[model samples]
Target: MNILEVNNLNKYFRQPTEFHVLKDLNFNVEKGKLTSITGKSGSGKSTLLYLLSTMDTDFDGSINISENEIKGKDNNWLANFRNEHIGFIFQFHFLLPEFSVFDNVMLPALKLGKLSKEEIENNAFELLCLLDVADQGKKKASLLSGGEQQRVAIARALINQPTLIIGDEPTGNLDSQNTAIVLDLFKELCKEKGQTILTVTHDEDFADRSDRIIHLKDGRIVT
Candidate 1:
């Protein structure tokens, strides 16, 4: 089944002569599969990702996610929908330096308020363990190495068990070893838990390993 559908998407920049970025893009991402979106710089890969994440609304088209039409929703509704159904991982870990690793991971769940504090804490610990960062749960986020911090960020993204995980160069800052660790983790998430992942990446190897690669060129799907 398709968990995401984008139809007739068009985006443009009004400044400096109304440049068109994406052109009539249409695609469907299957449920429980890992998909990668790849393109060279300026090909509109990141722009497409931002739209897919529902964080960019100034576009023309329809985006249906998990059976809901989300393209026209207001920011307030989109924010709530995003919190409930989507998790994001960016190139930067973006953890609060003063917060403990556990606390950092628990923030989303707390904002979600769907479970008790104890339950959220337990869930965070489980995710941290899954990411192999459970041992650093009590440490301030700033104290961890870059790799460790990334793992914590992943755990945080998983805390709410979102239906879809959106990543933008999730391993961009990591070394080779850490990159391998993250790649394996994403594979495991797909194979073991049937999680759906959509990532925008420049890493060829990373894109090669995903279940599907949606290659874009000049704002159009090339593959």
Candidate 2:
């Protein structure tokens, strides 16, 4: 089954005139597949992730998730859908410095108010354990190492049990060893849990681990 479908997607930024970022991009990601989107700096890889995650709405064309078109969904519904069905990991960890690692992971569940406090804590702890960071859960995010912090972010992203997990340069900040560790974790999760993932990266090593690679040049697919 296809989990995501983007057809003839076109996104333009208007500075003075229209400058296109994505041009007639079309792609489909199947359920339980780990896919990579790779391109140069000026390419629309991150923009595509934002659009797929419903964080950016300034675009033209159709994006369907489970047969529901994104264009027909209201902002309120889209926000809810993203929170409930999608998990995001950006290059920056985006963890609140003042919060404990556990709290940061549980933040999504807290904001949605769908899970009870006890349930949220339980889920958060389980995710932390899964990521091998259970012992650091009580520590402040600011105290953890770069890799530890990224793992915490991953745990938090998984807290909601999202079917689609999107990561933009998630391992960009890590060293070679840490990068391998994190990449392996994502690979294991995708296989063991049957989660669909769409990741954007410039790292060839990281991109090679994916089941399929989508290469982009100047905002268009080249391979």
Candidate 3:
């Protein structure tokens, strides 16, 4: 089944005299698959992702995720929807330096408040272990190495068991070995555990290894 559907999507930036960032895009992302979006620096990959994540509401189009249409939603509604249904992993490990790795992982679930604190803690730890970062759970986020920190970020993203995980150059900061590890983890998550993922990356190897790749050029999908 399709987990996400986008139709007639368009985005514009007026700050520099009205430049279109995404142009009439249409696509569907199936459940339990890892899809990658690839493009050059100005090809609107990141802009499209933000729209897909519902964090940029200034677009004109229909974005349906898990059967819910996100167009026209207020910021408050969008924020709640995002927390519950979508997880995000960015190039930078955006963890709170003062918080422990475990706490960073549990933060989102705590904000979500759908499960008990104990259950959330358990889930957080389990995710860390799954990502091979369980031993670093008690350490402050700043203490972990770059690769370890990224793994922790991945664990945090999975803590809520989101319907979809959105990644923006998730492995950009990792070494080659760590990049391979993350790609394999994504494959396992999709093929074995049935997770849906969409990522935007410049890493050729990463894009090539994904279940599917969508090429964008000059704000439009290309064949």
Candidate 4:
């Protein structure tokens, strides 16, 4: 089953003329597979991720997630859809420096108002434990090491149990040892939960671990 499908996708930004970030891109991610999108800098990899996740809507063509079309959809509905179905992990971790790691992870569940307090806490704790960072839950996210911080970010992303996990350079800041640890964790989680992951990374080692790799070149798939 295809968890995500993008067809003839085109995204352009207006500069002096027009900056074409993605041009007629087509791709699909099957369920329970780890897919990597690799490209050089400024090749629209992150732009593609943002577009698929509904973070940027200024584009053309279709992006279908689980049979639901993204283009031409209502903005409000798309926002809600992303909140309920997509989990994002960015390079920066994007954690609230002031909030405890537990609270950071619980924020999305609380905002969606879908999970009970007990359930939300349980899920958050479980994720942290799975990542081996449970003891840091009460501490501010800023206090954790780069690897630990990203681990917490991963846990926060999974709190909603999103079907599609989109990661953008998630291990970019980590050292070799930390990178290996995080990469192993990602692979283990996908198999353990049967989840789909689509990640954009320049790390060849990380890309090698994915089930499928879609290479991008100047906004198009290179095959």
TM-score of each: 0.98, 0.95, 0.97, 0.96
Give the residue spans of candidate 2 off by over 4 A. Answer: none
lDDT winner between 1 and 2, please give it: 1
Candidate 3 stretches greater than 4 Å from native: none
Residue 125, model 4: lDDT of: 95
lDDT of 4 by residue, 138-213 (tens): 9998899999999999998899989899999888889999899988888887788888888999999999998999
What C-alpha lDDT, on a 0 to 100 scale, does residue 155 get in candidate 3?
Answer: 85
RMSD of each: 0.9, 1.2, 1.0, 1.2
User: Which has the higher TM-score value, candidate number 1 or candidate number 2?
Assistant: 1
Task: Give me the displacement of residue 209 in model 4, in angstroms.
Answer: 1.2
Query: Candidate 2, residues 1-223: lDDT per residue as tens digits?
Result: 9999999999999988979989998989998888999988888887788888887777899999877788867889998998988999988999999999989999999998998999999999998999899999899999999999999999988888887899989999999999999988988988898888889998999999899999989989988
Q: Which ten residues in a row have the lowest lDDT in candidate 4?
A: 49-58
lDDT of each: 0.93, 0.90, 0.93, 0.90
Q: Candidate 3: deviation at residue 149, Å?
A: 0.7
Model 3 C-alpha lDDT per residue in residues 53-78, reported as the tens digit of each score: 99888888899999999988898999
Q: Give the residue spans of candidate 4 off by over 4 A.
A: none
